[model samples]
Target: MYSSLLMILGALVVGYMIPVKHPSALLTIRRLSSWMLYLILFLMGYGLAFIDNLSQNIIQLFSQSAVLVSLLLTFNLSALYFVGRYLAMPAAEPIHKKAITSLRCLKNLRCLSRC
Candidate 1:
């Protein structure tokens, strides 16, 4: 467990230290990381399937997970509701409907003509 934690932390530190300048490289890394996450989740489910009395324990797990999820949702929603209510945030226009700034419009027109 400690070794796993250390390796994960080391990789995280290395990731921060390395500079990825290319957009394509960043997209490739993101795709690979997502695949790795999916694989890990698949393997965990596979391992769980082989555990003894999992059928019996599954009910308990479901109930516990349901309760946990409900509590998390309730608390998060209530907090967000209270925050939104207390904070007098103005309703803003939708992004697509909002007027483009003169600088941005110039940049867009230049790019369209040149590129």
Candidate 2:
């Protein structure tokens, strides 16, 4: 277990050290990571489904999961709030809006009303 954890940390360090500059390579990495995460979650659910007395413990399991999610959200939000307050980040500029004229729509190949 310890060796496994050490190896995981080493991999993380190596991943951090390697810089991925290409957009296509980054996108491929992102897609692969997402699929891997989905597979892991599916396997976890599959394992849980085979556990004995799972039906009887469903409510307890849900409540525990809810509490855990709530705690994590609260902590994360509070931390972000404090850090943002300290940073005093500038507010985003409002987008400039223009009237959608028929001529503009013709040029853009999109018409809000009947073309």
Candidate 3:
């Protein structure tokens, strides 16, 4: 985790130093961001792969009560999503309206392309 933090910090520093007019700099940032996204996804997949073992551990800790386990898990996930939305710090309402409009345009273009 510390290594990942250091790597992110390094990337941010390098990204800040790169000249905006240089095409290669922007490309490098894009590639780095994509790789970082893939790495995170892989890590999440790895963790998810062990869910069965984790569930067993939870059962042991909770005395094999599935209902209690399900409720706890549901609440945890709900809390996470709510907190994430709260922390998203969305732009003002008008900007969001504009974004929605642009997204609708993009969807229309996609539909047209498909047709």
Q: TM-scores of all models?
A: 0.58, 0.57, 0.33
Stretches of candidate 3 off by over 4 Å are 47-52, 56-115
- Regions more than 4 Å wrong, model 2: 1-14, 90-115
Model 3: ten consecutive residues of lowest lDDT: 94-103
lDDT of each: 0.87, 0.87, 0.78
True-structure lDDT of candidate 1 = 0.87
Which candidate should be chosen as best, given TM-score against the real structure? 1
RMSD of 2: 8.0
Off by over 4 Å in 1: 1-21, 90-115
State the TM-score for model 2. 0.57
- Candidate 1's displacement at residue 72, Å, is 1.3
Worst 10 residues of 1 by lDDT: 106-115
The best-first sequence of candidates by TM-score reads 1, 2, 3
RMSD of each: 8.9, 8.0, 13.1
* Residue-by-residue lDDT tens digits, candidate 3, 4-104: 78988897899788668778977887898899889989997797687777866765756757778898999999999998888777776665433335557
Residue-wise C-alpha lDDT for candidate 2, range 1-115, written one tens digit per residue: 5986797689779988999999999999999988977996898799898989988999998999999999999999999999989988799998798677888888877464645
Which of candidates 1 and 2 is the stronger one according to TM-score?
1
The best-first sequence of candidates by lDDT reads 1, 2, 3
